[model samples]
Target: MDPEPRSAKGRRTRARLVEAGKTVFERDGFLQARITDIATEANVSHGSFYHYFDSKESLFREIAEEVEVRLVSMDDIAQDLTESAGPVDRIRAANKAYLAAYRKEAKIMRVIEEVSRYDDEVRKVRSKRDDYLAARLESAIKRLQADGLADQRIDERYAATALGGMVAKFAEMMFIGGARFDMNTAVEQLTYLWANALGLVPTADQKVPAKSATA
Candidate 1:
């Protein structure tokens, strides 16, 4: 493992190298990407690259960790919504945010997924990311059940795992697998499925606002 950069300049150089690694890895893939390419892209010396990362794989791991942070933060869309937002609206917002973030990072995500198939460490990182998301979803489902908004009969853990996997698979298919579909329609359909699965229904007094059809 490489030592942490203590100085501000060292931190900036490390961050630049990480960003450069992402660019090269997305363009040339993990097996084909080289430390020289990353160093060149970052406008840093080859020795500087070693100062931050022991190898290209180490740099790629750091990049994957950063991607996980961004993907996890996208889940906060539901929490950022107003209290009056209906279940369907919250689900839609979260799905939209997740899908959008996934799309933005699709290239790197594809590389990560490919590498995880054979690399044990990378696969562990991928599993950790999925587990974190599923745990959050489980908590949200439990809250819905407690509020009498979702089905109490459903097991929160299993429901969360299944539902979260559904959205993730859909995202992989659409963004990574090159499947074409209208973004707005995809979000609406995902929201409908998620709500129906949880048996979510708004009370008579809960007025759900209209949403734009435009993506």
Candidate 2:
């Protein structure tokens, strides 16, 4: 790997290369992306690409790390809403935030997912992101249980893992697999399922009408 650029111009140039690499990778994929295309996209010489990154793989690893950071940060943003929201509302907000982020980065995320299948470094980064999300969900579940909102009998770890994975896979399917789903409906249904899975009791204000027996 190249040393971090110190000068302002050098840093800008390096940043451009990274951005260009992402575009090229997303366009051509990991196996097909070339340093020449990245340099051309960045408006830099082929050798300049080498001055910033050792190889395409190195640049991709950096992007993968960045994506992981953004993903984890999205989770944090959702958690920030917890203090003011009820259980269902909080879960709905989290799902909305996650799905929005996934839609925005679907192309690059698809590339990262494909690369992680064969690249150990990328796979580790992906795993680390997943673990962080699961940990946060686990903590939230425990809090709900402690507050007498969620069922105490459920194992937090298993529930967290399952619920987190469910949301993630649902996002992947809707965004990457081209499954057509309305965002509002998706968030509502996911929130409903998550809350019910944990046996969350709704607050009085959130009560819904009961279905008739004939219906």
Candidate 3:
């Protein structure tokens, strides 16, 4: 295993390698990506690759971890679903942030999904990451119920998991499946579906926000 970098420049170089690894892995895949290629892409010495990561797979793991972090770092949407914001605004904010983040990392995410199919380590990382999202969504659903926005009888866990699945699949279909998708439409429709499914009744104005109907 590689030792931790103790200097600022060292840390920067290591981060560059990780960034390059994402590009190389997405372009060449996990099986075909090489340390030399990553080094070349990062404009660092080939030996420097080993200074931070023990192997290509280790680098891949780090990249996968980064992707996982991006997937759930919904700081823009905030987690207080029961905040003073109305259900419609909250739904729009969360859906918009999630879709935007997914679009930004779509390529690397596709690579992660593909490699996870046959790599146990990658699969575990992906599974854990997704479970975290689902758990958060489940909590949010419960909050909605408490706020009287969602049906009290709805099974939060299953509903959250199913909704999470639908969103992920829709993103993959649009971004990874090479389909021409309108992001505005996706966010609006998806937000509507989620809000309605949770039993939230939209007010006349909230039923279709201005931006929601544009696309």
Top lDDT prediction, candidate number? 2
Candidate 2 minimal-lDDT segment of 10 residues? 206-215
Report the Cα lDDT for candidate 1: 0.87
Model 1 lDDT tens row, 1-215: 34578888988888899899999999999999999999999999888788888999877887888897788788568665888787777888889999999989999999998999988888888888889999999999999999899998999999999999999899999988888877878887888789889999645754443554533
User: Which residue ranges in model 2 land beyond 4 Å of their true spot?
Assistant: 75-83, 204-215
Per-residue lDDT tens digits for candidate 2, residues 156-187, read: 99999999999999999999988877787787
lDDT of 3: 0.84
**Candidate 2 deviation (Cα RMSD):** 4.1
TM-score of each: 0.90, 0.90, 0.90
Clashes of 1: 0
Clashes of 3: 0
Output the TM-score of candidate 2: 0.90
Residues 1-215 of candidate 3 have per-residue lDDT tens digits of 34468889988889899999989988888788889999999999998788888899888987898788887787877764556678777777888888888889988888888888888998999888889989999998998998887999899999999988888888888778887767988888898899888998767776564543322
Write down the lDDT of every candidate, Cα atoms only.
0.87, 0.87, 0.84
